[model samples]
Target: MTQRLRFRTSIVLSCFVATNALAHEGHDHPHEAASAPQQMVATAAGPEANSFVADGVTYQWKHRPDLGLQPEAMVAAAKPGLHNNADEDPETGEVVTVVANYGLVKLDQQMKSWSLVDDQDPHFAGGMNSHGMDCFTIDGEVYYASASTNTQEVVVSKRGKVIARLESPKGTEFDNPGVNAYYKSGGRFVPCDVVWVPTAKRLLVVTGYSNGDFAISARRVDGAWKWDGVAFGGRIQQGGPFLTGHGIELKITEDGIETVQIASRGHGRLYGFTPNGAMINLNATEGQYYAQLHNAARPCNLDFQGDLTFVPLLDSLPSTNGVAPVMVLKNFESTGSLIPAEFDDLQFMRHMHGLKTVRRDRKLFAITLSWRNGGENGQGKLNDGQIAIFEAVATQ
Candidate 1:
């Protein structure tokens, strides 16, 4: 049976425009403008046939075709997982890369290709639409969050097996009041990503919409999983303006302060909050920082290291010839700066999504995905998806 699922991107963008308009009321700044154009410098290409060196970083390219992925299928959000191979290199151990498309797939080191891990898991209850996922290793078991379907619930899995399903703490029924109000459309939680916060001992689930629209909910999972509370636009208190809770990261400062950073897609702003849900005042320079980088039209995932963070800007509305770039920022404290970076001019890198860092042999690497529309029949030549791997080196 050929069942057509409503294009989620269109629905999500529509919600973003409506919610963003409401959130901007009474705010003084002009929300739609970038402070300055991004600055980029070209670098020499790499020596390897499939490699490129830019800004002192060396990257090796791989594609979905290399792994025998169907042209109609798509996958986004590449994250490092435990080495699933026993014959992996002893010195340079292989790291399995997990991607969520129709289901979870892991990079097979031996085959140098991608393989499905949990597409037919019974816990999916017959419907499996895996979106953003994050992993945590506790007690030797790797726990991951797979945003399944439009129910806005996260299926917690360990070792390719479903452990539990988390949804509204209020209950599964839609139309309930309060935080439950947002789930009324039969789309309770449009969760993008989920991360385990060791500092607070809770799981922070990033939802594209919540009660009153978008929000990030904290859930406790000591013996049983339950909602600790929810935060809309960095506030525990509800009834504020709506914001797109797309991507989230839990960061601990040098001085040991725990903070949660979120990519607000609706308003085009990156926000930092304490574990208790108080916004951390960034005090960024006018016309710089979030003011310039926040673009609702091109919001993507965020990855952090120390005080530095990387955010990939995927497809922009109206489209820019299908080019996406990554932004790197430093400090992230009261005072920090954003550095401009460039994306390789790869023909397959259209519509980028998901960003994460990986380490191998003491070298830093980045893995990202790109999606192209496959047309009405879902078989367009350009409608496929690809995965790219890059080795990052700090440039002086």
Candidate 2:
């Protein structure tokens, strides 16, 4: 059954929503109650069938429910979904995820145990770690890029072995790469997300909200990682960058130009730009498309499969018709509008942040992650979060 979601908008005054969330990278917290793992496969004819319809397609979402835990303590774990990546394990040939605080973890088939391969590398010597991480393979060797909020930098490792730690230029207190001259002052790096471009051999990053929110680029220079340029964003005072540059991904257009799609969480809009910081209109509209479409769902990390786009919301608000922890956008390259026919979720959960798709045996699956205590763990709960897997298929 396809449902139509009414468009609604929710706006926050300050970009300080991320201030308190910067402390969990080093502390040890309590875990959630444990339960037995459930079946991992999805079926079409069983009575346990749970599904939803969107854009003429039927998706049967099955919860591969488990007590998300750290491999060592076996305690319930919560993770800040600052960034996410899903790919096959080179050693075991199974699915794995590069989690924020947990490091590289293999998603077990039986759901009985999760194996942690590498612990996260704290970017600074003694700085507190925050959330955000991504994994990629180069020359058959796995590499991980982790965002350290407290340190305001990124730590790059080779299969868990520390390789590089990226920060602002030496002697500069703030990460003012100086790419744009308009914003005279720069703030803390407070990196939130990072994506590695395999073809170009470079990195694209998005920073936190508070004085951070800048979209910057990085690459290897003279055998060391250095800031290459800025794509967009700066302190909010500049009046031109972004409200909050949170999650970012690379998209290659049909015309052969590679564009960076950024999640401006504070403004509830997705902005696109070229490597040199030229804005690419997501929707071909007379005025700014983002100004017209304000998605209050608080779009977080983005995952793309061909023409289909999956985004998890950091806000608990439901869509026009019902709850949508995750929303799908079809033909995003051509149109960025949230039409009734193009927009549509799992039910009854709040603040999901990570989403990735995997294919096995010709079946498509979506893996999503939720935050612990739904953000700003006031009670100091452990970083365990809810992980859900859904099987999507075309009905037409």
Candidate 3:
């Protein structure tokens, strides 16, 4: 049978459980749930070649190498590299997406165009293949939190102009005993992902290499960012030593509870923690500790909407029969999936690294970043990068 056929059969036989639960997670066999066979969408011959409609939402996957930016200004963004993370500003619908070793670019409010902001020439940030961008506002002023992996610092910018660089300054809270060791990278920091918490008034930065969230005071007390110490993590959870800490998102509920969903990429587990570094157990495992969700190897990032979460797997998994790419999890269980070749060809979007969910004008969009997978040329650049936007319009 063809790969798609094989995948469909597997899904029918075992539902959406991509693979057997991790041996440590305690399931020896595949999970069984009642699920109808997925309806396949016929392929089309155009820009949007691969499209599907499920649950009243039309999902179209388009490879975006050229972000519609002017050729001359696409100096860094145009080339094939790790086009990693994409974050949108809710108030304006503007997006700030990043490419490692290239730099950052802005996706216009229209959601279909791109541009280079002033003072953002060259676009490259000197990082290797791991960088994340987040758009947030503080006190009516908007700013972006970009993980500068190369230097292990957080580059904060506004209107495309970098206003401050938050680093572990000497003789500060970061230098405090026991606190400095958890976030040390070449004696600095290796921030993989960053998000600003408005309620707590801090920036939770993932120490990408060290494996945990480091809370940096965004209050700018006396004109400098203060290190609030490690928020949560440091080799002591169910999955210890969460190396390569990659993606994170903030959720503030109506009851005044704030939870940050974190992707421990290295360990292939998802965790949730509060602003004060307390673990929030949403999965209801057994103890006071949080429950870890297992999916794919090096699961890069997460985007939560309502009760579901959108996760992009950085690589394949054997349990998935080697075809897992992107997953939609509801209550920490796979409820929907976008298999490889279902969205595009088997070769394209091979590695799903980053994901973000955006809602604007009554439409819901899922923006995903695929690192180093060239769909057009078959065997293009090894470090090639691409973005796929899947929009789901609301039903009347």
Which is the leading candidate under lDDT? Answer: 3
**Whole-structure CA lDDT of model 3:** 0.54
- Candidate 1 lDDT over residue span 1-396, tens digit each: 111111111111112212332222111123433333252111111133333343345444333233323223423322221101011112223333333323456554333555555454655433344445666655555666665434446777765577778765553322223444444334345566666777666677666543234444555456566665544342112333234466676666555666666765554456556665555544334322232343333445677644446665544332233344455554322111111122333454544556655555666555555444444114543423455556554433
Please list the C-alpha lDDT of all candidates, in the order they appear: 0.45, 0.50, 0.54
lDDT of 2: 0.50
| Local error of candidate 1 at residue 183 (angstroms) | 5.1
Query: How high is each candidate's TM-score?
Result: 0.63, 0.68, 0.72
| TM match of model 1 to true structure | 0.63
Better of 1 and 3 by lDDT: 3
The runs of at least 3 residues in candidate 2 whose Cα sits more than 4 Å from the true structure, single-residue gaps closed, are 1-55, 66-102, 108-113, 118-130, 137-140, 170-186, 235-237, 254-256, 289-294, 318-324, 332-349, 374-384, 393-396
List where candidate 3 sits over 4 angstroms from the true fold.
1-79, 100-103, 119-130, 168-176, 181-188, 211-218, 236-241, 319-324, 339-341, 373-383, 393-396
- Provide the lowest-lDDT 10-residue window in model 2: 39-48
The regions of model 1 sitting more than 4 angstroms off are 1-102, 108-111, 118-120, 123-127, 149-151, 169-187, 209-211, 216-222, 234-242, 283-297, 316-322, 332-346, 374-383, 393-396
List model 3 lDDT by residue over 1-396, tens digit each.
000100000110110111112221101112211122122111111112233344545455544434334334343453464546778865677777655555566777766766645576343444523366778887788877777665667777775666677665442454233344433422335577788887777788776443233333344566556665534454323233243457778866545567776776654566667665656655555442333444334567777666556777766655444433666665555555554434443345567777777766766666666665444346542433555566653334
lDDT of 1: 0.45
Find the candidate with the highest TM-score and give its number. 3
Worst 10 residues of 3 by lDDT: 1-10
Candidates sorted by lDDT, best first? 3, 2, 1
